[model samples]
Target chain A: MSSGDHTAHVHRDDYGSRMGMWLFLFTELILFGGLFLIYAVYRFMYPTEFHVAAMELDTVFGAVNTIILLTSSLTIAMSITALQRNRKTLSLVLQFATILLAISFMVNKYFEWGAKFGYGLYPGSEMLLDKPSGEILFFGLYYTMTGLHGLHVLIGIVFIGIIMYQVWIGRVHSTNYVRLESAGLYWHLVDIIWIFLFPLFYLII
Target chain B: MANGTLYMPETEPNYLDYRGRFKGILGWILSTDHKRIGLLYLYSMGLFLTVGIFFGFMMRLELIAPGKVIIEPQTYNSFFTLHGIIMIFLFIIPGLPAVFGNFFLPILIGAKDVAFPRINLLSWWLFAIGGGLAITSVFLPGGPADTGWTFYVPYSIRSTTNVLPAAFAAFILGFSSILTGINFVTTIHRLRAPGMDWFKMPLFIWSLYATAWIQVLATPIIGITLLLVAVERLFGIGLFDPALGGDPVLFQHLFWIYSHPAVYIMILPAMGVISEIIPVFARRTIFGYSFIAFSSLAIAFFGSLVWAHHMFTAGMSDTGRFVFSLLTFLVAIPSAIKVFNWIATLYKGSIQLAPPMLYALGFIFLFSIGGLTGLMQGALSINIHIHDTSFIVGHFHYVMFGGTGFGIFAALHYWLPKMYGRMYNEKRAKVGFWVLITGFNLLYFPMLVMGWLGMPRRYYDYLPEFHVYHFISTIGSWILITGLLIMAVNLILGVRRGAKATDNPWGGETLEWRIQTPPTHENFHEIPVITGGPYEYKINENGQEEKKYEEVT
Candidate 1:
């Protein structure tokens, strides 16, 4: 490696940046963890309600969104690898593609939520359907979970956009791949969260 | 390099060169230096503490007579709610660790700076913003929040108070804490000087590491929990509002999951401080270094599980109560281990009886009593009688106030010379220590007795029988406040004109004392590798010897 390429050799102190990200992810997990626990307890209490509520959600839409997210994750992973192989232009292209895919997933989510809203399933609105207690419980989980996941998708899109800028500006390259790796880790987490979200909201029913 | 002995010069005026001092007021406001950031937290927390104390004193004055003396009952509720909120979140939660820990942890560990100094600065600013918002809630149109610090839901939902601002402030403060935790964890993991292994690291860093874990892993739940409460309050959502078929108890669970570990977040660093002070004054290796270090981690690990103990009276099942109570008792074991080890470290060593040592000793005695009382409350049957009573309040005060508060004072005194390059009056410090400890017991101990006598807490007024205890507690509070005032004044004066401190005023073997009184921009002249455990104090053929590890570089 060139002597100017300081980032290639991971400084012993570099763990701080990585560890900070890991701890942040830990906090994010716990934040989402509490909601998961709530979902678990409520689901256990009202299985039939959850089942029916799960059925009401469009599986096809969710499945499409999942595919979009998964594909974005792949692009992000490839971007990191492209940067690692000194293919800066390729990396930037991949990051842009990832951001585009993330935005598309969010667009799909907007439509899906809009359809639910049209169906009188909006939380606290007059249009909210009068369902069994279990179904209401399921809807509560649905809104809270999907709303939170949507927030994550928005955040992911922003992060990818920033990464795209960094790559375009030639700040990211093979030697300086920590940012890409960190961003990839976050993108992968978003994908992993959707893996769970898909089965719970779409497949399990 | 040169036996790995960290040496800081005495007449090094350049060491105190605050880089942003040239920027004038803006320098302090926008500076990213950890020292300045720590001072910012100190000043903000000090202001909040004063406000909290004012509210507390008002409560005490109101109780001076059987009826309300200065304010109406609604005002009284707001006063006490602000008091609890400010004291718990604004002051004590960040009390020492945010102030001294931020200032000294990196220096003590011999690193150039905290791993994330910019984030460190951001945490303090967030704290200031949160504190400002919380205080502003006092004058809002609907009056201040009256749901107390815990903010239990249905009442919180229905109460015509400015609950949103207060809850939002708390949510923001949780973010500050999480950021600080993230910074500290990374610093401890990556910033240790070469050869400063986990076991050789100062107990303070170990405690901080554990505390940071709680901040990172637990505070977010409270953030979400508070946000949900705000959403419920503002938009009429019913997540926590039990009147709308929501479960208030679920709020309790979410709150305690964070709040329970939060108690440890308050004390673990105090325990770390006491460990540091004991070894320096006792002139010996800390008894059971590994155990003390691991106990901190153990406490952090177990602290999360026992949060359910707080929910015992919230109508949990018998099996749930049984499991929680048992876990609660188990949590105290690590604490007990720490107490035992501290005493053992002091067994046959030369004890200096300095002011810091005095406070450290006070922490041991008071924290022990507090921990034991906590165990008493942890018992399923006993908690039923005293769950919402003054006894529970008393127990927490002893732990939080007596334990964390006393430990903070100990650290202030211990590090005062190092931080400011001056010596405080020994006579004044001793008097302050004794007065504070005496007044602290007087202030809180009687509430325990009255709690047992069936006196409920948070009441504006009480029956005549409870008056005697309230009067005593109030008087004691005055004395406690006076002692704190004396301590603060003397230390401030001491910093300006006191005798210049030596490189190692206490002859302590820690890396912090090895540096200048006020450390340099870069803490060390040459980064010193750790050659010994922090508390190694023994004699060998090489004059006075200590356990020395190798230098990695």
Candidate 2:
């Protein structure tokens, strides 16, 4: 990352960087997209079982996590706007807020999953095994999708944390903040995938 | 290293010998030079390819006369699985794009380097790790996965072999592929030299652009699918478990969803290489430039829709089978357009059958056979017959080996001299080509024949009736290896001590030809301003010489 290291600094295009980030986000979407396809097929095959399985997932936890993620997305977006306006303090604070929200989302997820484990209702559990196969598949997808989403949240927190350090170091300021913007784009994608997952898993009838 | 007086005075050192803060091997592994990274891929891929070829050779030796030629049946199962994994993921999947694409994409488009140089290096590292994990699986507690490269479920889940590591290897390799795809797509879009419009870029760039999109979009599907498989195996996730009322057929759907389009990821860039070689060696502009370029996009787009053809015998709805079968047939049109255009480019032109052109022409011949047979298997009835036969094996090797393998050789021969500032021995390179081609056809064609005559693939033993075809195919493997050795030696010798090569050895009209023989770390002294199409060769209509377009200044 030294200026003398290589040609990465010679001709940097923020637009190109953003485009690369978007393309990467597309790959992320499709990765979860494959999981969603499986979810839909199974839900269709076992509707009543899926309905019964849906009841097991506490909507309060799902709704609380959804709102937390949505607010974090807004904070991250505002953090970029603040950076663009050269309000470094505001940007850092908003970034911290976003990171805090993401952590809360994870905390909510841990408890929700913990509750299920207490009930012995997880994948391959004896209780879940005694239930219908459709219910087994529903919880399987619920764990997989939310677990993957939670991992992304952790990664996003780390990503934003690093960007926060960069911002504090004055490396990313008003004039050069594509790194910040790219991270924001990734965080939003994480949020958007949750938007889809929440209604599909928690709100399913 | 100068070959002629027309060359300009050298300023910076060529990429090969250039040293940075990190010296020697560290310089290469840590350096972000696209050319150096390309060479890294080449050397690493070359190593893995040799390992893969050894596995293949042993398999062919095993199948030489049917019963117990070398390894036990379990060992044979592991060998074929490892062979498919190593060859497809390690060698061919990332084959042309990773090696040649990284080396030349920036240069071809008149740029200094790829869009994300660090990510480019990261991709190479990930590739090495993935390949390492795959090879290491064989030595792991259980032998390598016997579930084939497809890693079909139920068996993949039940088999106690080292499926986890193999699956993880494939998943990690998928990340490498996606990163390269992102780098290339962004580089092509944002880094094209000024005045180089989309239509004005080289056909190879066009093909890379299309291939990059597929790589980005399709590879992730495989990533998640494999992860699901691994999860099913470890945690009993039951997503693909039939015992849990999960549909195993869904795994096939998800796997092929990425994998079938992955065929395009392998071949489209090969087609791009052929497009570049054909016009350059023929000493004429490419025929139907837009058609050939558009055909690449067409192939990438339609190639995605036909994954289900692989599942025809997996009991798809009749309507689903019909749709996929039709899409498979439709996909053939764009490929045919390319083959026809290449042939027409050769027609009535003063064609130079150099080592590269020889391989390119051979690609055209072999890919056509591979492709047409593919259409045969696309038919629902025919697919039922040849679904798991040696014919399926023959069909892929012909296309994958004959098509992409030759394309890689052609690119190496065509570009390596420029990369190394030395020419390979023409006679030896040609001799290598002839031996390789003859051995290639002899090795694979019989598999196609025996497959038609009911020879099942992946079998350690076969019926006596299929013995002759297997025997002939096994001998073909020997010839093929000899030819490969000849080519490898000749190319290596050429790189080390061959005659100094001129800047534009084959009279190529692309931007790569305009750079130094062995390009400096920064490809162009200053990026050129392009003003015309990539293949704008001079024409001699009615014996009156005429230039095609305003030259890049």
Candidate 3:
């Protein structure tokens, strides 16, 4: 919807929007929560292999992506604050910056996955099949969890991109910025999940 | 009525009418009105029920005389698989919450509509798309999924059938469920009328609240599990594939983690419907109001912990088995609390033997049998004997079909008039109830016995020793289907041609009764300030409290 396309009816409230967003974030956490559960179970089953496989993950790339995600999380939170204070240009710029960081994180993820594929560590690969089952599981979880995390980064970018436009058009301004805040919370959630992911996959070694 | 008094006899633009901005079907299909959305769910559920039951009928027909009477084993496998998928995902899981919860939750809690109406509409659209995808899978080259609705790994991974579409369809349906949950929870928390406290809210809303939490929290696990299954099938992702270092049994762990809470999802709301009906007919305040209310939350909480009971025979540890078994039996307490309260509410009270009340009583009876048999199955030693047998199947049907199915019927009879503004033939409704119950018991009870005697489920062919139970069960299916048909015809005719009903026909104390019989498009003319609890049945003729003094004593 356009900036001026705000409907006249239906009373809107910030608290309800925030509560709805919080509840939704719970679902998203639990969405990744399931993956983490699987990860925990497998790690418990195969710690040595998981640790060995963790050494194979490119730490520099993961560390860089983690920095990008955390920074992006900061920018989005600042963006919401800026919007709340009616700093329109600043809010839009911060949001755009957040989007760029999300893209950078994904770019790093792509290279990491490509490097793994180059090494023939992809799921169901002959090389992977020859590895110990624990190593197979560690790499499997790495690719799947990070791949799913990458998907979230992609979704979060699109989400922020929309709000960036909304903020520009004044549809998501000081008076009506819950949309922006909600998107920010989602971005932070994506970042938080990556924070856990980065340590699990890259630092666990 | 809002206060057990005011109602609109004069006509207005009811939600059922094509009086909205969009003309005709678009008015409903495109509408964001909770009532319209509820109807959309109701209509779609009816369609799926028919499709599910027809498959069920075919399965029964094939099982009538034992060895592949009318269909091959493969066909039978696909039939039961498709039936379970459609019935569980499309019908039962979404049955009460999507339909009745949508229609009445807003009204009962004295809100104009749910917290997020647009999201509510979106939920239905997703439901439609998910349903379409499922139906489309049936005609695909490999035919419908034969891996069963559970989509247990290894077989699910190895099956040549269209697993991805079916699994993804369920995944998509789970989103609709999660969204509905979000809306209901937000609405309950944020949208209640000024004076309507949580306890003052009707038991249906309480049940919906409990159901919504499970839907929101538990559904995502299944969503991720299903997606992982799809991903595994699509790309040989070693997540659940044992050949790829993935454990297959872990799949069961994740599946039932959601699926078991899903049973509470199916039954809790049904129990809530019975709770609403019992006190209304009995003309007394609900016995143990907060007890019934908290017990709903209790069931939802305890229900999630008992998922491993499903895996006891799947090679669990003795400690794991012992723990899950204890939790499973413990979870039965809330349900028992509800049952006792319902009976106590009915005792010595001025009970109206209405069709709704009959179905309510029937629900208790059938659901009790279902619950008791479930206890039998839950016992660690006993479950090993009947793990994959017809006894488990019988217990499942009694709870789901007999309990939730009859629960839906009771709800339909009780509120259809408020929905359509017309009354059905009570005598005919009762006849449908009777035949359905009789056919139900005859159909399922024997399976329980046969299960104990070692009749394995999901088999197209049975040994001649099991032939007698199969025959009787098939006959029961016939009677059940006939009863269902009669009930369907009766309700359909009532909606079309029956006499118009007055608002507050039941003289119940819910807010929906305060408005038009068929509520207006906006639902409330003015948002009602709740004055009292939902089931305060007033005294009649002699100004007595309508106490069945002796019965309570």
Candidate 4:
């Protein structure tokens, strides 16, 4: 209802872009939260079958991807610090490291799923479908949750590559870095999802 | 002017008269100005509402006689689906907030536009694109989504229609909603003028804040849930297919987590508009403004917890039923507090029965009945009896259509003049209101009675016992449509040929009324500092009232 000084201030960044990013992250959390809820309910319903299904997933692959995503998250986090400290080249190197880790994570997922498909364990396959319905349900959650996570990792890699391009051209710099920070936050979220997914889908007994 | 060099004439170029970067329709379609975006929403929503009305008309006509009169059972199912989807997503959810909130949120908070102007424009385009996809689904190769708007699990996954595009349409619309939420929350936090603080803001902004949070937090759940349903159909995911060990109830859980609070999203803004209108028309500061404001937050919080009330008959455990039923009742407290405050504000006040005020009053009466019936359904025992019956249908209409629908109607009548700088025929507006009320009550009331008599909903035909009630309801539809035409025609004439509106049309004390009618593109030439509350009508030293708004030096 009240106004401030009538002097026209040229800086129109009344709302910091970082605030918008944080708000967007809230939505991303809820999006995965839905999947987690489905996981919880279905797991409770068929605890024995879910446990059996978890045993079939190769923990070696799950563990390796988790480590890869965790390291990528760290690199992306450090890259923001590098950019903020005005080390442009070091920032780009760290960004490259992060994308490399994301690619390895996806490549690991491909072989794991390829092996499962080799055994005819893919969703709706006769071998899995012929098993107890709980096993089908268990595999369903694993694929949907991990596949959705993979999509995010892929999107995060593209997003970081774009940010790196912006940094190289000086469009993003030490003083102007919300874009890089947003991309970092997204990468960390993808990492955190893996952190949870690794245990719930692969480690849980 | 602050520098004493600039001058503003009474006939300065209004927002409508001013042109932007693009020309012709592109200027409006692509403009980042919040006002123009608001108008874009209004025009698009109006078109969808007409289509929605036609669907409802067909359904009611088919129901006039119990059997198939114009279409078969399958077509009737699709008819209801189209009607529900169009009304719920395209109209009610976005209606008030998108149209009025966009236009006035910045102006009322004393800012030029929302925090992110380009993002605001993007949200509208998303909405239009989402709406277009949904409409296209109606005629696509598969012949529309035959699943009800709820799109309950296995059926939705198994439907032969174009479920993917239709469900994706709602999913894409969620992005539009989420972006708007981020914009509004940031705007209210950052854009308020120097003297304006959280407590000093209007009730409408407070309600929008609550609604925005739900949009931000809860909408994603439904978005992802809908995506899962689409995935199940596309791939045999069996996520919710009972035959595949998937739980159908889980789908309801995910869906209602967003939608249950979505009811508040639909109604809270309407309540805010009524809060604005009642105080202005009654010429009083709102009764317990803080209470009304806090009640909005309360409704948002508790509304989220009560989603399972909709699932009581879906075979939820007894404990879950008990907890959800109690939470549902608790949400009613805040909504009722708002109704009480509006009534208290009107007590012994200089009440003006303008068209907008009449609509607000109608909203209160209709929403109260809706709210009471909601409480009735919230009770586990009562809900079991009326579950899936016409009573549930009646209750939702009283709430969603009667409550939120009339809220939008009231807002249209109230704010159209401010946007266009012209007033509608007040006398004709009153006549329209009376007929609309009679028709609305006639339209929905029998459903409550017949619902108690065990007339099930979603049925294409009914036994002879339910015939009388069905006939009464169809007649009510005719009356309601007649009244709607009158109101629509009156408002159209007001825009085309009515006289100009003054700055302070109803002695409103908000910041928008203090500025030029219809407003300029940048809103204010220079921001004014406030020294008092938004609704105070104070007496000056001469024992007379001062200007409705004043600038502090």
Candidate 5:
């Protein structure tokens, strides 16, 4: 009870906050789940087209971005640990590191999307790619999924920036770490989503 | 103290003091106080309800003639769409929970405030903003969305109306619902008094708990689905447009995913109200308390999976239809359990025919018919006969309006004295109830017959053979509207000059009734540690019911 209250007074009930965040994550999973179900049905119907389209994605770029996201997840986890131990400076540093890695992931994605756009692979673009019928379907899902993921990453960066400011101002301390934990949890989720995206769009044979 | 009336001098800043009346008004409008925020929701929602009822009246008037008499076809289409959107999103979903649940949940659970007061206020503001956007869309150049509230895809995408703004408004409203759910979940879990265990909490809190779960879990799907619709309209995204190789059925899947659980989100709190009213008026413990609580949860859980039943006639596969029909039938079992428990609770108890109790009885009888008719729709064979007819509309009205709407009125009447510190005229209340009930049946009952006779819904005109039923329904609508107006006036008068109410007006054992009417800012002067279950009806040595509270100090 003491530990619960101690955690609760500063963090305002981690059990509730954590449960709420998990519920949110569940909703996120279901949102993407709808898209995933669509991807499954479409891929099953047009296996050959999906494979040809998957081959167009740069695996090297996808693997590098995956590593970047995975490392950012580590940095975020370490930052949570730092905040819990009252190491404000160390936590701030780690958060910056995580943010930098996230930026690197986005930068790599930018060039890859640029290359696709240059090849006329963009949806509704004048650059007509091979196999018009199924290629449009492939690219449609591609842009929607990655574009939505990019938007999430942007939101995650903003969340981390807010936490960084709170730490800098000394508003967050060892007693108050729930926000940090929740932010870290969100950052890791963004990374995990990218992990699946890599395999589905880049690594699949 | 013994009489439970603690009056301070009128000279001082009493509980009713509007001293910072200007600031108080602004404070209520803008401040993050949960109570004030709750009242803000009440006023805003009431405004929307008035607008929605006017639209409904127009719809009824338009139906009075077989052809377009009152309004043109396009205007009629938009009118009914606006009516559906406002009544469902603005009134019914947030009706009881936002106004009543926000005001009373904390007090009933012995807490000073909801866990996240600022977020609570944010939810109300979001609702206001969303509602404003919806209303603004009505004046758009293309006119308001006539795609119906469901906004089924192929037609929705092809329609040249203001689908983007209307759908975006719905999307924004979903966030308000989600935030409120998060706030309530945290408050109920963290802020209960020392001895108020999960099972020991009032049934209202229990209903809210179930409702919050649905809001949290289900609202986001609609949020994203509506956003997809907006995106589709804006960029011609092929998510639901079949001409662009997108599947329209996917839209149905996503829409129903949220809209189905949304029905539970609307009704579960009302069920909580019925549970509270029954035990109090019947002078007994609620029969099968755990069963009732679990049934609310069961309804929430099963409600999500049965949404595909709405898509049966929309060209789903034979397998998909069969599975959804089976799941739909499964969902009814939990609702049946609740009805059975309500009946069992009334068994072997002294039943008082209070206004609230009468509404509860009305709810049971009507919801039973609603639920049973729903099972008929669940049958693929029967559905093909009655799909999209007035039967579907009549069935939902029985559940939503007859079940949830009547239940909300019951709760308002039951709690008004405790909330406003005044008693309404009992005689007038009974009269209003009977008129509303009779009119409600008269209005909707004919629709069931007309539907069976194959009268389609959402049409501006119908055949002459359907005229008698439509005429009856129109008259019934007039009667229903008048009854509602009378009830509203009665409550207003009651608030002004009625008798000052005692705390335990219904003689219930809930913690909310233990406090003075219009409770203090902190709710409890001192927090109570619960000593017994919520529906404790046992008599003490004097052969009278024991008072639950020991002492204030």
Candidate 6:
């Protein structure tokens, strides 16, 4: 019922904004769902090869990254709570903590992927091309799925960094924190995707 | 306007004339107003439509005599491929919803604008960039994609043409569709007028509600799948390339998964437009309002299950084909319900054969032909027989072009006055309708016959036995383009200088007609409170139906 002006007086609907974020998150899930379907089909087709390839993935690295993502999700959630309590400094600290965890997760992924690349085990690599077709496909899905998931982690870090600044400026605070809350929702989605990716790629065997 | 300050007019101005921070072209493009955004889609779609039709016309001319009249076979391949890409992605997919839905969804529901105005503006920008990339692929080094719009893998991965840009364009467009869907769903859920409830909302809103859900849920699948094609191409990933231990059939499954429901995304909004038009012109309250509303949901829900029907001829298990065939038939029930309701609404009413009503009736006839032919293809045996034939092409054109395209034309005729505050010439509009419908059937009907006679589609040249059909279809293309040109010119002239129109030119009983012509910057001066159905036309003591305005603003 407000005027359709862009900036004179903002029309804020917290519930509507949250609902839109959830709907967007659903689309993100479906986006990853396509890749998951591919993973399932390939896994079913080349069971032995997938098992052999899963054995190649370092479980310790996957487990550590999983813990990192889960903790980042918690810190983002707590940041929302801190903002709700009007503790701006605490909220910013928590957001920065989440961003640090996200960066650490990406760093661990870098060393893991770097180890695989050192073995020439990437899509279209000469060493991979010499392997069995099923094994090649296993590495292909590995890179595509985990690689896409890594991109999401990087995006989450950038998003939280922006929201952290917004909170510092008092634009998003106790009374109006949907912006921070939406960033948390996106960050959680990134974490949940990694949770599924962890078992499917690293622990399936 | 001062820097960093919006220029809010002292008195409310029509959205078309509203001055904002930006001026001229910048104003139209940068403005977050829903009305201006709708016009932006309309104008961009107009440009794409002309280019797409030209491609179709050239393909038709090349087929007129047989062995390559105008271009080489490779060029012909790019022509149909580009034609399908432009028409499907740029024209029909966003056709009705982007143009009419953006303009009217908020107004029809008695709201100021969509839930997220900036996101809505972003959707249009994505559409433009996606479309630009697609057309720009034509002049790129490798030329436009010849993998067809579906971009079926193996060949798609191996093709030397610019499949990358085209595939990326569709992926970008999918994002735009998803954003629009999110915006509409949020707006409808949160921004309805004070008293308008679920059932009392306009049937068009119901159709959009269904269509928006499909857009949100279905488009992301295509987004990822197309990206997979790009990945497979760039990295030689073994996703769909058979040489790399990939199954090509999987690509078909994933492609149609989104695309099959995408048909609903295109038509459901068109159905909404028809629902709005039929009752207004027939001068009666819509019969079976809930049925029409629910049928839209039914179509959206059932449409997703029937993607395998497209894969039947592509080779799947018998049980899989059987299940998908059955689901395909189930989806038709809702469409039939809508067709029957439109017919019943026409019966025993003061029917005016206005230009919009004419297009509505045309949609019923043409879409029935299209839908019935679809069922014909849904049969396992019949589908294999006509799977890649010209019959499939005919069936698609009948539905996408005849049904949804006509529905868009009807919307233009019905709502353009409200949009531009001017009226198009009625006699010329009726003439345009007749010519277009006549040319339309002439262009497509022969494809059904030729296809039944075993003429395959996507062939550069056909046998001499198919010559007559191709000739007639080509002639029909000429007439159809002429009809299109006539209508385009008439509408353009009308927008420029037609007579000023009254607010409620068609006596529409919806919330839109209750407002000012070419509505103000905020659609309603005061947000309305609705107390009755969208098409509540009461009968007077003189035994004629009269609309009673029960809505309070």
- Judged by lDDT, which candidate is best? 2
Extract clashing residue pairs from model 2. none
Can you tell me which runs of candidate 4 are displaced by over 4 Å? A1-15, B1-7, B10-12, B539-553
Scored by DockQ, the top model is: 2
RMSD of 5: 4.2
What is the C-alpha lDDT profile of model 5 across B184-302, one tens digit per residue? 88889888987888898888889999999899888878887887777767765456667666777888888988999999999999999999999988888999999988988888888
Superposition error at B524 for model 2 (Å): 0.8
The predicted structure with the larger DockQ, 3 or 4, is 3
Segments of candidate 3 deviating more than 4 angstroms? A1-9, B4-12, B539-553
**lDDT (10s digit) by residue, model 4, range B1-553:** 0111121655457888876556788778878788999999999999999999999999999999877789998899999999988888999999988999999999888888888778888999999999999999999998878898999988998889888998999999999999999999988988887688788788999999999999999999999999999888888976899989888988998999999989989999999999989988777788998999999999999998999898899999999998999888898899889999999999977777888999999999999999999988988998999999999999999998889988998999888878998878889999998998899888899999999999999888999899888999999999999999999999999888787876667767778877777888777777766556777643222433323212212
Worst 10 residues of 4 chain A by lDDT: A1-10
Q: For model 4, report the TM-score of its A chain.
A: 0.93
Fnat by candidate, in order: 0.38, 0.68, 0.61, 0.66, 0.22, 0.66
Residue-level lDDT for A31 in candidate 3: 91
lDDT of 5 at B443: 88
TM-score of 2: 0.97
lDDT of 2 by residue, B381-493 (tens): 89899888999999999999999999999999999988888888889999999999899989999999988888888899999998898888999999999999999999999
Model 3: per-residue lDDT, tens digit, B1-553?
2554333445456777636557778777778888889989999999989999999999999999966588888888899999999999999999999999999998888877888888899999999999999999999999889998999999999999988899999999999999999999999999898888887999999999999999999999999999988888777777878887788888899999999999999999999999999988888889999999999999999999999998988998899999999999999899999999999998877888989999999999999999999999889999999999999999999999989999999999999988988888878999998999999988999999999999999988889999899989999999999999999999999889887777767757688878876887667766777777787765454645322111111
Cα lDDT listed for each candidate: 0.82, 0.90, 0.88, 0.87, 0.82, 0.89
Q: Lowest summed lDDT over 10 consecutive residues: which window, candidate 5 chain B?
A: B1-10
Estimate the TM-score for candidate 1. Answer: 0.94
Which docking band does candidate 6 fall into?
Answer: medium
Q: TM-scores across all candidates?
A: 0.94, 0.97, 0.97, 0.95, 0.93, 0.97
Q: State how far residue B221 of model 3 sits from its true place (Å).
A: 0.6
* lDDT (Cα, tens digit) per residue for candidate 5, span A1-205: 1112112223256777776777677667766776676677677767887888788998999899999999999999999898888788899999999999989889998999999888677765655333544555667778888888999888999999998998898877788788888888888888878888889888767
What range of 10 consecutive residues in model 6 chain B has the weakest lDDT sum? B1-10
Model 6: DockQ against the native? 0.59
| CAPRI-style quality class for the chain A–B interface of candidate 4 | acceptable
Model 6, residue B15: distance off in Å is 1.1
Docking class of 2: medium
